[model samples]
Target: MTKSGNVLQKINNNYDELSERYNFTILPRSTRWNSVNRLGFSSTYLIRQGRVIEAIEVAELYTEYQPKSWQAYESLAKAFEANEDNLQALKNVKIAVRLVDNEVNKSLLLAYINQGDRVNMQLRSVKSLTLICLMLFLMVLTACNNDSKLDFDAFVEKKLTDFLIEENAQVASIAIVNDKLNYQKQFGEFPDGTKPHHDTVYEIASITKTYTGLLLAKAVVDKKVQLDEDIRVYLQDGDYQNLQHLGKPITLRHLATHRSGLPQDFAYTSADIKSGKAFELFSNYSEAKFFEDLAQYQLTSMPGETFQYSNVGANLTGYILENVYNQPLSTLVAQLITEQSGEEHTRFRLEPSEISKITRGVDRNGKIAPLLSPHSFAEGGLTSTAASIADYMQYLLSTQAEEVLLSRTLLTETSSEHGHAFFWNTYEYHSANPMFYHSGGSIGTSTWLALYPKQKLGIFIATNVSANNTQGKLNDIANAIVEKYEQVGQSK
Candidate 1:
C-alpha cells in the first residue's frame, strides 16, 4: 500500500477501536493512551508534520466515530481552521459548543465560538486586502509588460485550471451568456484521461430547483394552483395533520422559498447522510415511501416563517406540480423549460445511448462515485451539457415570459442584499440590480448558476468532483469571470 493509504488505514483502525469503546457517546474526562487519545495524537502529529489534508481526514474520521463527543468536534474544527477553512471550522466549533455538557468544557468551547466573529472579520479583511493587492499588481504588470493583460476568456481558463488543480477536481464545464457573448468551455478530463467537450453531459443537481420554480410559476400563471393555497389540499393520500405548525399550512410559496417547515430529507439525519446510509435508502426510494414519510413528518416551525432548505419539501412541491399538470416532472420540464430554451440535451431522463456522454465524477477521496439517478426530480436530477446550459441561460436572459418574470420576483427577503425568488437566491435585492443565483451538488458533482438580469449576464459552472468546498470554489470562479467581463466592458 502507498504511504497515504497506510496512514488512512491506521486512522480507520484507530477510529474503529474508538467507536467500539465509546459507541458514539461523549468522551469521559479520563484519557490515558486510549483509542481517542491515540487518534487525536495522530491527527495533531499529522498537522505538525505539514500534512493538513491527512490531519483533516483523521479528524473527520474521529468525529464520525464519536459524533456526540465535543472533543471530537473541537478537534475537527481545529483541523479545519489550520487548513484555512474558516467556514467549516466555525460550523464545527459551533456544534462543539452546543454539544459540550460540563461548564469547564463549555468554557473552553466558548473561546472557539468567540473566534467565529473574528474569523468572519478576518475573512472580510483578507478579501479587501486581496482585492487591493490584485489591483495594484495588475496595474504594475500592465505598466511593465503590455502583453501581460489577459482577456476575459484567458482569465477564465487560467482561473478554472488553477481551481481544478487546487481542489483536486477532475472535470469542469462552464458557460457564460450575455448580449455580446455566448461562451462555453470544458476543462480537465475523466479518470481515464479522456478530455471533455462542450457537449459532455453533467448532473446539474439542485440547479434543477430553478427549473422547478419556473414550473411552479407557470402553474400559477395558468391558474392551476395558488401560491398561498394549503399544500394539504392537493395531497390526496393521507390526512397529514402534522404538516402544519401553529395553524399555518405549508404553501407552494413556502416550498419554493425553503420555508416549508419540513426536514431536510425524508428519512435520514445528517449523520446517516455522512455514513452513506441515506444514499442507500434513496436508491430504492419510491413515491409511496416518500408520502409515507411525509405523513409522519411533524413541522418544526410555522410554514413560511422559517427558512430551512428541505429536499423533501422540494420533492413534495414537484409531486404537487405533477398532480396539478397531470404529467410527470420530466414531461413538464420538456414542455416548459428545455423545449422553450432549445436545450436539446437537457432532461431529467436520458436515453441509454446518451448516457455514455455523461462524464464520470470523482469524490474527494479520489474514488469514482456513482452517477446520481433521478429521485427527487425537482430538488435535483437533471443532466445537461455546458452548451445546453448556455442555450438555457440565453433563453432566461432574453425571455420576458410571465412565468420567468414571476420566478425572478422576490418571494422572501432575509436582508437588504439577500432574498429568495421562488427557488432562486436573489442577491443585491434592495439595489434593484438583482442577481439570481443557486448552487447544486450531488454525490460527486458540484455546480453554480448566476444571472444578472439588468446586465443580461448569466454564468454557469460545474465540476465533476464534489467536496465540502467545491461549490464555494465554483462561486469564486463565476465571480472572477464576472469581474473580468465587467472590466473588459468598462475598458471598451
Candidate 2:
C-alpha cells in the first residue's frame, strides 16, 4: 500500500476510538467547530494520502459540516475531478469560484474551469465529427444506410422489449441523461390489456436498503447517530443483550455493509410464509418482536469479520434510527430522500390516490401474485415508480445529495467485482472508475438502480414480473445503455 493508503487504513482503525474520545459529549459552538475541523482534516488527509473515493466521501461530510465555506466546496470539487467526474467537478468549482473573494483560490478555481472547458471542447468536436461521418455514410450508401442516426429512444425501447420478451413478462423503464429524465417506456401489458403508465409503481425490494442507507447517512449528518458507535447504545439495556458476536458489538457501519454477522431474516418459519397473508407474515411485525427474536440469535462470525448480506441487519439499523429520531421509517425516508429529491411516488405506505398507480406483480406463470412483506419495513417494503426512482437517482447523479451514497465505502469482495457502499454494490464496468448499482426483487417484481459517478450517468429499471433471470436481464440492459453512451462519447 502507498503511504496515503497506510494513513487511510490507520484513520479507519482509529475512527471509532477517536470519536468516542473527543465527541462523546459534544457541546456548543466550540466543540462543533472542532468536529468540523477534524472532518475537514480527514477529508484533506484522504486527498493527500491518495484515497480518491474516501477523500470524496469525507469531503462531502466536510461540506455538510461546514456548508458555507468556499474552501470546503473547492476541496470537494478537487476530489470530484480526481475521481474523473468532470461534470460535478466543474459544478462545484464554479460554486467555489463564486463564493471566494480572495484572488488566490479564485484563480485556482478558474484554472480548473479552463481545464474542464478544454475537455468539453474536445467532446464537442468529436460529436461534430461523428455527425459528419454519419451524414457522409448515409449519402454514400443510400441503399443500405439503415438509419444510423443513433436514436437513443429506439435503442432503449428495443433493449427493453428484448429483455421483457426474454423474461416473458412486462416492464417499466425510465432513462435519465445529464440530470434530466428523457425517456419513459413500457413493455408488454397485463392480461386485461392494461399498459403501465408513467406513474406505475413496483415493489423495489432490496432497493429499499438504499433508502435505509440514506437515512443512516442523514442521521450521521444531523449528529443523531454515528456510524462507528455500537448499535446497542440505541436499544434498551437488555433488548439486544444477545446481539453481540463473541464480545464485539455490531456497529451501524457493519450492518450497512452487511458484515454485522446477523442472519438474513427473523426466525419466522416456512409455515408463516405459507399463510398467504401479508400481515400474518411480516406487515405488522413489531420492533419489540424483532428484539425478542434478536435476543436469541447467534452470530456466524465476529462483527465486521465477514461479509454476510443481512436484511435483518438493515432492519435493525432502521429500528435504531427510529429510536434516535423518534419517527417512523416512512417519515424519515420522506424527509430525507423522497421529499428532498422531489420523488413524489416513492413511499412505504401509499396514499389512496397513489394506490391505483401500483403495477401489481405477476408470477412466473403470468398470474397476479400476492404482495410480499419482508422481515421488516426496512428490509424490502418500499414501492416506487420508474420516474420516482429515476428522480432519486438523478439526485445522486447530480451530487447534490449525500456523497456517502456514491462513495466506495467498503472493500469487501462481493459477487460484484468492485466493492460495496452502504447498500449499493460497485462493479468494474469500463475502468477503475467503477459503476455503482443495486437490484431488488420481490415475489413478482424486480427493480434496478445503476450509476457511473465518474460520468455522472445512471439508468433505472423496474418491472412488474419476476423471472428466474430478471437480475441478469437488468444488468444486461444497464450495461448496454452505458455502452451506448460511451460509444456516443467515443464517436465525438
lDDT by residue (tens digit), candidate 1, 302-327: 78888899888888889999999999
- Report the C-alpha lDDT of model 2 over 63-143, residue by residue, as the tens digit: 664444577787787777667676676566556654553344555545444444322312245444553354344335422
- Least lDDT summed over 10 consecutive residues: which range in candidate 1? 24-33
RMSD of each candidate? 24.7, 14.7
Per-model TM against the reference: 0.68, 0.65
Look at candidate 2 and tell me the lDDT of residue 325: 96
Q: How close is candidate 2 to the true structure, as a TM-score?
A: 0.65
Cα lDDT of candidate 2 equals 0.67
lDDT of each: 0.75, 0.67
- Give the Cα error of residue 38 in candidate 1, in Å: 70
Off by over 4 Å in 1: 1-150, 350-352, 490-492
